[model samples]
Target: MKQSLTLSWLLAVAFFAHSQSFNNLPVNTQKPPLHGRHWMAITGKPLAATAGAMIFTKGGNAVDASCAMLAATCTMWDVLSWGGETQALIYNPKTKKVIAINALGVAPTGATPEFFKGKGMKYPPEYGPLAAVTPGTPGGLMVMLAEFGTMSLKEVLAPAMQMAEGYPIEAQTANSIERGKEQIKQWKYSTKVFLPHLGEKREAPNAGEIFVQKDLLETLKKLVEAEQEALKKGKNRKEAIYAAYDRFYKGDIAKEFARGCQEQGGLITEQDLANWKVKIEEPLMTTYKGIEVYKLQQWTQGPAMLQTLNILENFDLKSMGYNSTRYIHTLYQAMNLAFADRDFYYGDPAFPPDEPIKGLLSKEYAKERAKLINPDRNDPNAKPGDPYPFEGKTNPYLTLLEKWGTAHLHKPTSQNPLDENFLEEFAAGTTSVEAADKEGWVVSITPSGGWVPACIAGNTGIGMSQRMQSFVLDEKENPFNVVAPGKRPRVTLTPSMALKDGKPFLSFAKQAGDEQDQLLIQFFLNMVEFNMTVQEACEAPSFKTYQMYSSFGKHEKAVGSLTLNSEMPAWIRKELSRMGYKITYQDRTSGPINAIYFDWENGSFWGGSSNHGEDYGIGW
Candidate 1:
C-alpha cells in the first residue's frame, strides 16, 4: 500500500508538469464518427459488428454483445477461427473495476524446445498442426458469457450458428483462401472446407457466394444441446454454460479435435483440452495524467504500453507537438526501450523464474530508462535495462543479456518496410472487438490465431491455434519465452481501457501483431495530448518502430526501422531520415483501430472505426 501511494504521488507530479491542453481543431475524417445514447458495437468485419448490434437490440449487455461479435468474427474467419485464443478486458459497472480474461492457449504435450530443435528448427513452425496449441476461444466465450453476461449461450451464438449454415463470403476472406490454397490443401479437412470449388480454376469460394460449413453448424448445435441437457437437469445458467464448455473441451468435440490433430502431425491431445482453463485475473495498471490505464499482465506484450507510458511521463509530450520530429523520436525511443525489456522479461507468469513486473512498472525505474534516450538520433542499439535491481534483486541472466546484445548488434538492418515478407509477418493475424452499453459495461478484446490457411481439427470444424510459433527455442533470444509444454507464449495480442474520475473513459484495441501496443500508445496520446476526438484518433496517421523482436515467424527484429503514414509532411519525413532513422511510407499506417469513448458529460458513447480496413461500427 505504501508503494502504491508513492507511485501514485510520482505519477501525479508527472501529470501536473504536462497538464497544458492543446486546442481542439476541426477535423474531417474519412469515416464519420458514430454517436449513440444506448449502445455501440465495433469490430474488424461489417457483418460481425452487425451481429453485436443484433444482440444489443435484443437487450443484451456489452458482454453478451461482445461475445456475439467474437463468435461471428471467428465463424467468418475474420483473421481468426474457433480454435484460436481470446484476450479481453471487461469493465463491470456494478464493481467499478476492470477484470482481465486470459483465454490464451498453452503449448500442448510434447511441445518442448528440445522437441522442436530435434526437428531441425530454431523456432516452431508458423503453420500446420505441428504449430498448434490447444484451442481457447470456445472455453473463453463460455466462461465470459456465463459469469458476466445475462444471455444464454443459445441466444449469443445464434448469429454465428446462422453464419455457419451459410453466409455470403466476403472478398477479403475469399481472396485470402485463394491465396493460401496450397497450404490449405496440405490439411485434408481444411481442403474439404476451404476449397469447395476444388479442381476449378479458382478452387476457393468467390466473393458473394454462399459459403457453408455444415460441420461447424453441427458443432454449434451440439454445444446448445449440452446446455439444454444441463438445464433440464436443473442446472443454473452458469452451470448450463459450463456443461457446454465441458462438451467442447472434454467430450466428443475434444475427442475429434485430438484425433484430427494427431492425424495432421500436431501435438495436442485430449488431455491438453481438458486441462486448459480460462483465468479471470486482476489486470495491471498505471496512471497517465490521472487516467487509470489497464492492460493484461506480462504473459502478453500489453504491459509494454504501460512501460512506454511511464517513460513518456518524463517528457512534455503535448508541448513536443503532435507528429513533430521531437514527438516521434521521443515516443519511438520510449517504445523501443520498453519493448526491449518486454522481449527479455515477459512470459507466462505461471512458469518458473518470475518476471520483475514490480520494478518494470516502477515510475522511478522508468525515469532511469528515460535517461538512456538520445535527444538527436534514433538509438539503433537500445538494449533491455536491468529492472531486477529496482525490485531488490540481481538479474540472473546477465551473461545471457550480454550475449544477446552482441548478437543483436551483428544483425542486418532493413530500411524497407515495403518488403512483402516483413509486412506480412508484422501485421500477421488478429481482430479487435469493442463494445459499450448504457449500463456502463465496456469491453475491449483482441482475439487471434487459427486464421486463414488454418489446420482444421478433424470433423469439429474447429481450426487449431498456431500460437506456438510465438515461442522461442533459444534462451538467448528470450529466456522467459522458450517453448515448454503447458506454457503460454508471450503473445502480441493486447486490449486497452482507461478510466477517468472512476468512470468508463475509453475502450480500444487493434489487429496487428507486434505493432498493437506501439499503435495503441499513439492513439491514446492523440486523444489526451492533442485533443483529437476518438474518430480522429482512430484515423490519425501514426508511425511504427520495428526495433523489437517480432512475436511470429523466425522472431526477427529490424533496427532503426520506422514506417510513417504517407500523408505525413515531407519536412517531417526529411527531418526524421536525417536522425539516423530508416524511413518507410504507407498510406494506411493506422492499421484497424476500433475504439469507444464514453462521453460522460453527454451521457452517451462515441465510436471510432479506422478507415484503414473493413472495420465497421453500429451505434444507437
Candidate 2:
C-alpha cells in the first residue's frame, strides 16, 4: 500500500522549536572550523548551507561544495533552485584573477515579441511566451565543477539526491510551499512535484513530512554516473566536466527538455539548447576611496553600483550624518541619476548599440549629473539629464500598452507622488555564499529567481526568473516584456566583492530586485566611510525610493516615496518630510544578506546574515 503522507506531514506549532534545531543551527557554530587548508561561508536556508558546509569539510573544493549546495537548495528550498541562472564572481588566489560564470540562460530561439502580442497578452500574463528562457543553473554549476572543483559529480550530488529522495520538510520550507501552493497549481509540472496527489484539493505538507522529488533525484543520478564514467576513462577533470554539460545541454536530457517546452508553449528548441553556452566576461570594476569594487556587467543592473559610487564620491557621506535628510537626499539623487541612465542605456549588450559604460561612469559625467540635485526641494519630476554627449542622441524606448496608445512623459503629479502609499508589509528571501582560503583567493556567488508561478521543470528544478515584470509598457506597443530572441531580460541578481589592501576584505550579496544595487551601495558606504562592523552595517535601518525600473522603457516616471524601515529614527522621517520628500514608514525586515569579511590583522573570518531570514552565516 502507498504510504499515507497526510498524517506524516501534518506538524503542530508546539514542535516548532525542535524543527528549528534541525533547520536553524546557530549560523556561526553550525560548521566546525576548517584547518589551514580551506574555509567557506554560505547564506541561504540554514539546512541547505549546512549541507554544503559538510561537503567542504569532507575535502570538497569550492566548486564541489557550490554544486552540492545548488542541488540541495533545489529540493529543500524550491523557491530558489537549479533551474534558474547562477551568476558568480570567483577569484583564484593562485592566479590572482577574477572569473565570472554567466550561467544565466537566454530566451529560447523560438521566442519572439510577436508571440505574446499574438496571444493578446498585456504586461503580466500568468504564464506563456514571456516566461520562456534557457534555464542556466544546472549548466553553470556543472561547468564550474568540471573546470575548478576537486570532486566528481556523483560525490557532489550525493547529499542532495539522498535528501530529495527522503527528507523532512521543516516548518520554514513548508511555509514557503504553502504560500506558493496556489501558483504551483497553475502549472502541470509544478503541481506534479509540489502537489502530487490531491490535484485541486491539494494542501501543504506539514513540518516533519518527508518531501521527496523522485524525478529530480533520478535526473541527478544520471549526471553523476555519466560524470564518473568520463573520469574513469582517464579523461582529465576538464573533459569529465564537459561530459556532464553534454549530458544536459546537448545529450539525452536536452531532448527531454525540448519536448517539455514544445508541449507547454515554451520557446525552447533543440537548436537553442545545443547552441547555449555560458559566457565568461570581465566584471565591471571601479575604485571607491582606493578600494576596488567589482560587479556583473550590463546584462544585469550591476553597473548601477558604479554610477551610485561615482555620485557619492563627490559628497562627504561621512559628514552628512547617518540616515539624515541630507544623507538620504544625496543618496536618492545619486540613485535617480543612475536609475535614469539605466532606463535609457541598460540592456543586453548583444542587442543594438546603447550608451557605453565609459561615458556613464565618467568622472565629469557624474559631477555634471550631481549638480542637478537641490537639497532644499525635491525634483518632483526629475529625468535623466544630458550628462554625456551621447545621452541626447539616445531616445527613450517607448513601451506601448494594449489599450493605451503610447506612454506619455508626464511631470510628477499628486496622482503619482514621489511617495505614493502602498501596502507596507515585510517580505524576504535568500541565496549567497562566500569562501576564502589563507592564500587570499575568495569566491562570492549569489543565485536568485522569484518564488512561485516561476518554478523550474521537474527533475531540472530550476526556478525561471520573473524579472521581466520590470519592463514597462510603451504606448502603442502591443505587449510589454515580450520575450524576444536573444534579448537578455533585466536581472536583479547582482554579486559584489570588495578588495582592501589588495586582498578580499568584504564579499557581500543580497536578494531584492531594484534594491540589490541600492542596498550594496549603502552597506559599502557604511563600512568604508562610517567604519561600521559587518553586522552593524547591515543591521542599520534603511529606506529606498523606486522611481523607475532599470530596463529600456518610456513610461511616466512615477516617484514612489521613501519607504523607511521602522527601525529608522522618526526624526529621520520628519527630516525627510521637511525636505519635500514623501516618507512611508514600513516594517524594516529585508531579505537574507550574507557577507564574509576577512580580518587581515587577526587572520580570521567573520560572517553575518540578515536578522529577518532564517539563515545563519556559517564560517570558520
Candidate 3:
C-alpha cells in the first residue's frame, strides 16, 4: 500500500509539471519516459506490460513480446479482448521492411448499408447482437506470432489465460465496464461474462475487485490445446502456430462463434469464419522533412496524418512558435483539408478505384490542397481537393454527391452538433502497444472492440466486435465508406511508425476514435520539428477541428469548428477566435497516446505511455 502511494505521488507531480510549459521549452519538472539499452514494452495497462516483459526475459523479440502483451490485454474487457480487432505495423530490420496487418472483422457477408436503411434505420443500431461483426482478434494475434515470433502459443498465452480466470480489475477497466453496464444487462451472456458483479447489487466490478472471466480462460485454453495437438502431430513451430490460428477461425471456436452470431440476429455463419483471412498489405510510406513516415492505407484514417504532415512541410513551423495561434491555425486547416479528401476518396481496396490514393499522398497534390487554406478564415464546410490531375480524370465517386437533396439519400441531418455519441456506439474503446528488442525488431499494434454492447459467444465467454457500425448507411453518397459484404469498414484504429531517413525512429498510436491521427500529428511535430523529448512532446497542448465528416456512423461533422485545450494561453485562444476559427475548450491531458523512440546514435530506446488512465512504459 505504501509503494502504491509513492507511485501515485510521483505521477501526480509529473502530470502537473507537464501541463505547464514556457516558450515551447519543457520546464524539466516532468518525468520523462524511461530510456534503456535492451528491450522495452509499453502498453495500455501495467499487467500487459509485465506480460510483455516476461516474454523478453524468456529471450523473445518484440514480435513475441507484442503477441504476449496483446493477449494479456485481452484478459480483461476494458478496451480490448479476444473478440477485438487487431491492426499492426511490424518492422523487421533484417529485411529492412515494414508490413501492415489488417486483422479486423468484416460485415458478416450479409451486411449492406441498404439492409439497415431498409429496416427504417437512418443510423445503424449501436447495441445488441445485431451490431456484431465476425471477430478477428484471436486470429490476427495468432497469425502475427506465426510469421514473426519465435515463442510458442502455449508460452505467450500463459499470462493472458491465467488472468482471464481472475485478475484485480483496474480503475479504468472498471469505469469502462460501468459505461457499458446497461448494454451488458441486455445480453445474458455478456452480463454473465463481463458484469458478473451484477448478480450482486453492483452493476459492474469496482477497481481492485477480483474479477474473473471463466469463459475467456477456457477459450484461451482451447487455443493452447490446439497448438499442442499440432506439435504432437510432428508439426514445426510455425505450423503449430498456424494450428492455433485455425483453431480460432476454422475449428471449434469458429463453430461456437457462428452459432452465437446466428442467435443474436447476426448473419455470420460457420463458412464466414472459415473463409475469413486477414490481408497483409504493403505499408503506406511517405517522406516528411526527409524522414519516412509509415501508416496503413485509407482503409483506416492513417494517411490523413501523412497528408497533414505533407501540407505543413510547406511552411517553416519553427518560426511559427510551437502551439502558437499561427501553428494551431495552420495545423487545424491542414487536418480539415486532409479529412475532407479522406471522406470523399478513401475506402475499401475491394472497391474499384475512382482515382489512385497515391496521388492524394503526393507532395504536388498537397501543395494544391494547401492553397485552399485561408489565412483569414476557417472553412465551415471544407470540400475535397481534386487530385484527379495527378492520378488522371476524376472518378465517378468524386462527384457522386454535393448538395444532399436527392444526394441527401441517407440520414437526415439534425441541427445537433456532430456528437461523438455515434462513434460511442460503434467503436469499442481501443488500446495501443509498442514493443522492441535489442536487435531492432519493432512492433506497434492497436487492439479494439469487445467493450460495452459486446456480444459474448454464448457460454464461450469470448466477446465479438460491433465495428460494422462504422460503415455508412447511405450507399450512394458515401462512395468510399458504404457498407458491403466481405468489406472491412474504414476503421479509425490506425497504428503507425515514423522512420528517419529510411530507419526506424518512432512508433506511436492514439485511441481517440477518428481524432487519433490528428492528435498524434502534433506529437510527431513536437518531437521531429521542435526536438522535445517523448514526454514533453506528448504533454504539449493539442488543437483539433471537427470540420469534416467523421469516419463513423451517420457521418456527422461540425464544419469550420475547432477545439483547443483550455490549458493553452488565453491570448492564443482569443487570437484563434479572431482568425475566424470556431473555438471551443477541452482537456489537455495525454495518454491514450502511447509511443516509443529509437535513438540509433546512442543505441538505446525511450518509451512513453500517456499518463491518462492506467498506462505505463517499462523497460530494461
lDDT of each: 0.90, 0.64, 0.76
Of candidate 2, the 10-residue stretch with the lowest lDDT total is: 5-14
Query: Top model by TM-score, which number?
Result: 1
Q: Flag the better candidate by TM-score, 1 or 3.
A: 1
Provide TM-scores for the models: 0.96, 0.84, 0.92
Report residue 434 deviation for candidate 2 (angstroms): 2.3
lDDT tens digits by residue: candidate 3, 1-620: 54553354344333433442223443441346777789989888889999999999999999999999998887766576677788999999899899999898877766877688788876556555656677888888988899889989999998888788788988777877777788777777888876766666667888898888877788888889989999999999999988978888888888987887678677878888888898788988788878889999788888988888999888877666667667778888889888877766777876654436878998999998888888777766677777767876655554454542232212314453334564353233578889988898999998887765577877778777767767776645456777777777778888999888778899888776777888889888878766777866666556766666655555566655667765566666688878876666666535368888998899999887665556676799
What clash count goes with each model? 0, 14, 2
Candidate 2: tens digits of C-alpha lDDT, residues 212-236: 7777776777787677788899987
**TM-score ranking, best first:** 1, 3, 2
